[model samples]
Target: MAETYPVLQEAEPFYFEGNDIGILVIHGFTGSTQSMRDLGEAYAKEGYTVCGPRLKGHGTHYYEMEQTTYADWIASVEEGYQWLKERCQTIFVTGLSMGGTLTLYMAENHPDIQAIIPINAAIDIPDMAALQNERETRFLDAIGSDIKKPYVRELAYDKTPVKSVKEIVMLMEKVRNGLHKIQCPALIFVSTEDHVVPPGNSQMIFDNISSRQKRLVQLDNSYHVATLDNDKELIIEETLRFIKRS
Candidate 1:
């Protein structure tokens, strides 16, 4: 039997209608829409239609996350994309951490995406071998809310399910292999001192993606959750600029 968990506060999905340009905002692994609401609202303020989908098995509980697969998470994003497609002429996708990996996945599978902004995306997990070997551990310490800003925290799971971690690794492998298939303009961001995903992941993504129009930016004052960190404004501003030019 499957266990059910209640959704956490401030973790509900959000949608804002606006102009023809649609922006799909995705949160990271073990995270909820709360981590991306600020960015979504900013885009909405700029007259861009925004949709922030709550990924399956997330925003509820780590136990629920363990029951989900990467395919389920991708399906959540696909539903959001299709919703936007129905009403908008142009679409842009951006995400944080695992969300960023999904963004790349979308770009690879759907060429209709206008551009992408991946913030601190994970590609190569340096300790993946170790994680894979640990068969007994069901969960690990929380990897969320890596923000440098004081008093600010992301709405993410306090524990990470090992099963979900494996799913993300599988997704990363798939996305990495399909990098060449992503030809849309891209803007990648990496925090200089990210505690979760290493900065090198962004570099590898930049070098592998076939996008001719791509830029890599470094956030000096933030960490992995840059969207909710001190440099949140920078991410919002730069993303808007990237969308306009792309």
Candidate 2:
């Protein structure tokens, strides 16, 4: 990273209710806690300790992430793990996109997680990876550094580093390699027609996870970012049920 990590202030105040229920809602790639704000508030209103930490190298200068690796991203989630330990007796973690990959990583590594919910979670990139030709496209741009940019919205910022995309792909590989290790209850949410990460990504997790109580939900009217779409409320309700059961 180009600059030292800033001590980001918490997005929402901690609601200290007596309820021991808790949730850690993680956002998608290049997204901040803002994307999960509504869902976080829904859980918080129910007196759950909802912690949504901005992943490393996100919600800031994208160029600063040129050197950042997926390891840094996982470290950010680890910090959230420590923060939530004392807040609730049982903790549920849920994430979107790359966030979902990290959630599986956590659930696989940390057996103590009460339950896990991955919304439009991406794992096993080669199955249905993002971008048509991301590696070649990114490499050409990097070599020239003067090539006309492609993509939209994100390209409006500093173009995604080729290395960063590779790192995310590596993250997917790591998560896929450890999929069967996740024995905890899992609620996998997927959009039937996700433009970013396809539904196969979710199925990969559902197929590999050993959780007997696991489930998969196909969301319509939503693309890649289901956490912010109309089906979010259903996700919230179903997740609450899964957490209670587990």
List model 1 lDDT by residue over 36-121, tens digit each: 99999999999999999999999998999999999999999999999999989999999999999999999999999999999999
TM-score of each: 0.98, 0.83
Clash pairs (backbone) in predicted model 1: none
RMSD per candidate (Å) reads 0.8, 5.9
CA lDDT of every candidate: 0.93, 0.73
Q: List model 2 lDDT by residue over 1-246, tens digit each.
A: 257555334422232343677787887665566667778888887778878877777766566666679999999888887778876788889998888999999999999998899988877656234543555554312111111122212211234566677788888888999999898888899888776676888888899998988999888756666666667788889887777678
Q: What global local distance difference test value does model 1 have?
A: 0.93
The local lDDT score (0 to 100) that residue 185 gets in candidate 1 is 96
Q: Between which residue pairs do clashes occur in model 2?
A: none
lDDT of 2 at 137: 54
